[model samples]
Target: MATVPSSSEVPPLAKYLASTDKKTRDKAIKQLAVVLSDPSQVTLPHSDMSKLWKGIFYCFWMSDKPLVQQALASELAEILLEIPSTSMTFDFLQGFWEATVREWSGIDRLRIDKYYMLVRRFVNASFRLLMRMDWEPSSCERYNSILAQRGGPLCSDDIRVPTSLAYHLADIYLEELDRALGISPEPSPSPAPLSTLLNPFFILAARTPTKITYDRIQSVLFEPLFTALTPKPDDQPPSRKKPRLSTPTYSNLIANACLSDPKAEGAVESEKLRKALLRRIFDVASGEDTRDANRRKMYNLWKSHMEDEDSSGQTAVDAS
Candidate 1:
């Protein structure tokens, strides 16, 4: 029977790292530091190497192994920063972060906390990278390819990379790209109208007892909506026709806002706020000309309810 060769028999670089000799180990570490720090060399494909990429990723995610973890993190950061194209770099980092998140579940709480810091670092890095991408047809095609090939949208089996994170990352990527390119980030080809902006607050007031002054309503909600709704002049068609509103519909926005802040306090007030907001949304849906009629009917209904609530002195409604 043939005996397997000891690690000492391997090439000097590998042998030094795997060797027990202090001098050899130190030399290997220094060489690795150089290779890892060099972005071009690090990304070069080493097809014959067994699990080299996986091992690097493992070191990055395993914070319990402090020395290895720090080495990998430093190298990863350096490589990411050196990449010229923000989109490609961001996609790579996002994939890496997703893998790290999956690895996190089995880690101890203390280590998990440290890993969270790494996660934040990756997120911030991704955000910055996104700021540099061209959000044109080419970038969209690239994103669609990644989403389709990675099984990113429908799966969360891997904790390191959840579908929600992937989706949000894509959105942020596109949004930043649009901003950088001076284009509208919205999918619709048209720009939103001013009346569409005020629709939600109208609907919500009719549905609940919450009464938000226009100023508070604008501050809390409309500003963000307007930013997203308003399109760049260059994004409009060459014909100069009035562009249609392309902002997210009221219900979708409400749902997203609620889901975003699930633990927001003052549940009763929150519900009222949502309802008031929804009313404005309905007006938007109904069109500007019809908004007055809708508002009057809603106001009458709201007044009747307010009187009843005041008469009964009921602070909360019973669900059952």
Candidate 2:
């Protein structure tokens, strides 16, 4: 309901933009992020808003200070939820993607917490947008346009999948999938299908087969998720608990995406991928590392899913 700057205060916002001090510029970016998060302020047209975010994005992009970009990207989750329109969200996504491509590995450069927050919001905002709208049509349209839409992929062609971001997106999707499977201490009363819930990542996986490689599939996606599925020692505080990996749902997402992709061959590759996935899952779930009830649940799901896959003649014993 509030405006960023009532008519007269606009000059100060602009002046802050030009300030030489890093502190002043950082504060300006922070305030701009907050202002952009509001959907209620509709005075500015969507096209202009897109450019506004673009301008802000480039400021972060060109800035020598990495902290400034992290500060802006951190606001993405909240802004994603409150953005005025999907069009504008795409602009923000594009800006974020390009900035990431320039050099923004979550664990390496930025602190995990900052990167973690961005991923969590990005994935959730993506899914929420997909679920609310008929993205298939827009995706189809954008694909044919031949003009790259600003910000992340709206369609296959407009899509440019960053490997680092892709893996993190997959991680967040899997984590949410784990929660959706009703494995946690408090599962959802009504859960969405894994395919539906993780549609955004599926779109990414489907589009970016080239970027989503074997090593990344292991190191970035499976390894971290496997670690999370591994239950912590009971002596540890409940606050430190990792997410319970829903192996069955996890298997389902991969199978559905791989099978559906024209690039990914049938049962053979998908099965191999599944087995590789299960192998890591087995090590963590069945490994005698931690003694927690989740280990058994994970193993049981893995065993049952394997049987189902084998019965269908879709199970391949290959490393992912």
Candidate 3:
């Protein structure tokens, strides 16, 4: 038998993590969960965690069938919950985020949906973990900071990750928080403040360098409210049913926060935006003659611009 000399080689777990055989991958993940749940077994540094995430990313990449991918995603996110310590959980999450953002550009349309679901699952799991921690202020801030980081899904610093991921986050955010809070054990936990729940958005709006990205975030966060508050034209027929609103109770709170949160903008700029949005609401509600025509026109133009971008293949990025 010929012997091959070996120096540093691939980690044993990496092979299994990327295995195409379903059982092999599942077994590897379960073992990983155990190790993560017990810090004494393995202490993962940032670099090690990052390397592990590459294999885990491929694990999801190699998975076929939506149902199977979903199951795998849930299992992977659940690993965070299994981790014994807060620091480990945060490290595990940072590794996951870095890996996803690092590889986001290569994801194709066919595989994109699964990855989006994976992001949602991980996001929900994060909230659950925070709830488990009693939503400690420092922990919550750290969590939001990760999401708002330069290469994070929220993508404040660059366009490397498409804004679609952020849009999806905005679309599902409040509902996921509601679900996380609802599932808390009896003698319900003290409510996490609306301000904290909305912090990530404030940070993104405050710090995003591009107008397009800011407009995109603004539309996703507040457009529904604009629709709900606007009155239908007299000539238009009544709708069959009222549309379901998105976190309607928080509508005022979010608006006020956007206007008042010093972190979101300077006092002057915040006042200007506040007045602009308020005027838009009044104009939209009054059903009068072309009062908010410029905003309406600009909004339509932005919509068209987004469509053009999407057609040019700027759709989604995986945060898997």
Candidate 4:
């Protein structure tokens, strides 16, 4: 493995990181990960860390072809795992988010999909790092704070942060968590902090700079269910739409099942989290006066679901 240069020569490392030659770029990344994992060996100040991430951002930007991009994204995310210290892992995660946010608006249409993939891989990586720690409360709380707190990446008041990032984060939360924990429809014991897993969401709902972003985030989270309930323009008729909603689970099977089945085996803990998330959405929708048909339809569906459950004499999950 090629070694990193001395601290004084660090500035030029970005060239190596963004090299078209795979072998050169790969060595730079590995060496950078080693330095990050044990910073005492070669101290990198905050500014240098920021610059290195810029190189990494473009490293992905210059990545070739879909398969290569996919592999590179996974490799980049795995850096978080390589770090022996949790504190440095978060620093790296924060650096990644900062670099991405700074450049998000500049991403053009052609390259947008690749950046989206990059974000998804990072989110999954963050979850994997947490799961490795057994979802320790302080670690989860710290991670959530970094992502959703004021001035943080997802919930920052800065308009430059872009609503799409928050929307994407919301879109992937359940999917990635399920993926990270290997969750499936089959009954399995819930992980610890399972109930509080979504506390970041409520923080996001309250702190995100704009209502538009919040609505977008909320819409993405609930869209799977709403989409299942909704029919396409070319639908045959109302009769045919029943099959769509009853499809057991659409693309988001595990999450949809959690919403539809109150007594889902091994879902007691997950159910609490799901209900709280839905309650937040429902409460927000209730306050809006707009009668957009889809919003109205979604509201009614939730209302009916909650009412039926309430009348069934099932104990209500406190969504506080």
Q: Residue 84 CA error for candidate 4 (Å)?
A: 0.4
Clashing pairs in 2: 94-151, 94-152, 276-320
The true-versus-predicted C-alpha distance at residue 283 of model 1, in Å, is 17
Comparison by lDDT, 1 against 4, better one? 4
**Model 3 regions more than 4 Å off:** 1-10, 39-43, 223-320
Q: If candidate 2 were superposed on the true structure by all CA atoms, what would the RMSD be?
A: 12.6
lDDT of 3: 0.64
Q: Against the unseen true structure, what C-alpha lDDT does each candidate score?
A: 0.38, 0.45, 0.64, 0.63
Most TM-score-accurate candidate: 4
What TM-score quantifies how close candidate 4 is to the native fold?
Answer: 0.70
Per-residue lDDT for 1-320 in model 1, tens only?
32322334324455455555545554654564454444443232232122222344444433345665554455555455555443434445545544454444466656654554454444334323332342233443343343333333212232334433333332333233233223324332121111222222333322322223332343334444433433336755453323345533333222222211223421223344434443444334345433343445444433333432233533332211
> Model 4, range 1-320, lDDT digits (tens) per residue?
32333557666777788788888888888877767776453334567678788888888888768999999898889888887766667777888888887898898988899999998998888877876775666787788777765545666456667777777778777677657666433344235343345555544554554667657655555544444433345744454223433332333334322322223333333345445545655554444543344344435545544552443533343332
Candidate of highest lDDT: 3
Collision count for each candidate, in order: 21, 3, 0, 0
The list of candidate 4 runs beyond 4 A from truth reads 1-9, 20-22, 38-44, 183-195, 207-211, 223-305, 311-320
Residue pairs in candidate 4 whose N, alpha carbon or C atoms collide under 3 angstroms: none
- Worst lDDT window (10 residues) for model 1? 189-198
Q: Model 3, clash count?
A: 0
